[model samples]
Target: MVNPVRKDGTLDPALSIKNRFIDISPPKVVGLSNGVKAIEWKDGKVIMLDQSRLPLEVKYIECTDYHIIAEGIKKLWIRGAPAIGIAAAMGIALGAQDITAKNYREFIKGIETIFDVMLSTRPTAVNIKWAVERIKRLLKERRGESVNRLKELLIEEAKKIHEEDIEVNKAIGRWGSQFIKDGDTVLTHCNAGCLATGGYGTATAPIFVAIEQGKKIQVIADETRPV
Candidate 1:
């Protein structure tokens, strides 16, 4: 479950940990999770939408190597802070699986390179660092497990991170809608919408939630064109 945004606009992380599960059924609670997932972990790889193909074609890049994911992040193929974070976690999982390690000690040593690659991709994007730290903590806590078990656990943890991202995005939409009035026009800059997040959006979440609440709202985004 996503913790409700506090009054001061910071997340109360404790609220999310109280429960083990939360329902995010689509088109029922909100239209936020209706369709389209920008990133996912599937078939033992990280599958991410190729954002550079926008307005021309829809394509997904299946990355088995952390290097591929790192390039995607650096090139903005997997754009958005939240999306980048998810990519980082999945990239770490992908990297972990290929580690030529025979034991926990060797496995831990191998992930240093993976974390370095991911962290170097986007220094400004704090979520990327945050995501890497999560994997680091997991590795530290589970350092005693067998190599195969640790690999499986890393994959599982990465998937959990993906799921949690969507949940938080939904929560953002729900909470932000309260500020959106009927017939309001929301102006935004850059890409903080569906393509930039796990789902719903960061800046666009309120608009979506408002529309679903039967409040007609307009959205004008300052869509940037690369020079």
Candidate 2:
């Protein structure tokens, strides 16, 4: 004879909630949901999801042309300043993938369309415009080079843009941790770190660094809401 619900004699529901609601038992650091997927590059196509509708409806759209990707960036389906810059670079790469231009003028025209579209994605982020403009300049300056080589360069540069974000986060953490003592409370406003950037996060980096250093800290996550 045993009581089913009181097997452990405790009223806490943490066990039941974790077992029922969570997909992974112990949780994985790089779960499928958060991990990066391999970029599927067809002969001439851009297949990607509009991330703005995410945490709501998981929708993936194919960009037959560069215009769609530009709109996705501007509309914020794919945001975050650094992320947007990376996306813009990708957009240029995608735009150039199928180019069969016969002369320098025609080639420059195609890339320029993409450049203008990408710059319009988000007006506020200086980095976004800067990235697109840099690519545009590279293409313009090297008009005599092979178009295929230029596209390869674009892809490599885009990867760098995304990779640097990780370094940025780690550096922020190292520098900011010096301010925190052994035991202190931290208050974070909005999601300014990992989610906002790429990996390490911006405002949230120091807190993580302090925690790793064995500093005692309490985090007050501000719930942004209209009062």
Candidate 3:
């Protein structure tokens, strides 16, 4: 979740925790998740299309609710591994925003419910479950604090996970792109490109950026099987 916009239209600190670990410049917008808003991208941008709809509608739906986000994950709106993890984190944050409890015990129970709700969104994606559990662990440790405070912290932590992924991709691109020289014919499986991740696509991100930097590489897109 991108930091919730404050009254002044500035991103709140709680939303900016992800900025600490990475440099992300992709253009995005807000969508409603369960009545609470969450960050999503706009159309005609680097990572705008609902990738699963690729070569088809090119349509991108802004996910505002946890339910929608979860469905997106299951349906492959964002199919890549890193992208799924980021989406899962955002889903947890969206679910956690509605938790209301005055006492520690009740608050903990509230979070447990929220966690279960978010986790139920998808089952096959290990990264999705991992990210949700990560947030749940943090929420458990922060049970002593006010519920509102814990919500903010959990959302921020989730954002951090989303942001860190972009940096990780960049590093991988820098190192991996070097393996392919100009004019090399490379065969790739599946659709892994800019539209699949935050910064760049994994496995093929380095190849895309390398091409942009004037490094010549011929890519063979395989449509028959998984990469």
Candidate 4:
């Protein structure tokens, strides 16, 4: 049976506690509890949870084409600061996967086009620019490498961005949890939690961390309403 994927694409803690893994070919990024990831890069391609189908069906989107990633961002199939940023980085990597460039100069030229296109998908998100520029900088520093090596480096770097986001969010969770003590009730605005972040989320990170820390905390999201 398909488990319901939350707005954050996390699995039901009750059902997914025993298993969570990724399938490379068909590209399934199923989650375990809070371990869910909204987007992932695999086999030089992008795999994402179809968030638009939430509360009804759980589906995944495997994009071998970078343009599809861009379209996902534009259409909110992938929404969230860190997530969209991760998507851009992965999309750039996927876009570069098929480039038949013979030399560094030609390869970089194509990367520049991809970099801009990914950024345009979500111009306001700082993370998108942060991620794209990081990739751009990686290329600039690795100009001495061959095109094939550069392509590989881009994929690895994109994965690094994805990993880094999880860590960063965890760090935030640890630090923020301090403010949330046992029996505290926290009120937050829209998309401040896992709903719009890489993993643990921004504002919601503390609550999850607090709970893990053995705190009894209640949360009220100002933006959430019954359908």
- The number of the candidate with the highest lDDT is 1
List ranges where model 2 is wrong by over 4 Å: 1-51, 54-65, 223-227
Q: Give the C-alpha lDDT of model 1.
A: 0.79
What lDDT tens digits, residue by residue, belong to model 3 across residues 54-168?
4555576665566777677667666766667777777667666776778778877766665566567666667777887788688678778887887678668766886677677
lDDT digits (tens) for residues 1-227 of candidate 4? 66657778887776563333221111121211445657877666688877777648667899999999999998888787888888898999999988889898899888888888888888898989999888888988999999989988989998898888778888888999998877777777766555355666776777677776777666655565422
Residue 5 lDDT in candidate 2: 51
For residue 15, what is the lDDT in candidate 2?
A: 43
Between prediction 1 and prediction 2, the one with superior TM-score is 1
Worst 10 residues of 2 by lDDT: 22-31
Those runs of model 1 whose alpha carbons end farther than 4 Å from true positions after fitting are 1-34, 224-227
Candidate 4 lDDT (Cα, whole model)?
Answer: 0.76
Write one digit per residue (lDDT tens) for candidate 1, span 106-186: 888998989888889998899999998888898889888999999999899888987787778778889999998876666
Sort by lDDT, best first: what order?
A: 1, 4, 2, 3
TM-score quality measure for candidate 3: 0.70
Error of 1 at 201 (Å): 0.8
If both were scored by lDDT, which would come out higher, candidate 2 or candidate 4? 4
| lDDT (CA) per prediction | 0.79, 0.64, 0.61, 0.76
**TM-score per model over all chains:** 0.81, 0.69, 0.70, 0.81
Off by over 4 Å in 4: 1-35, 225-227
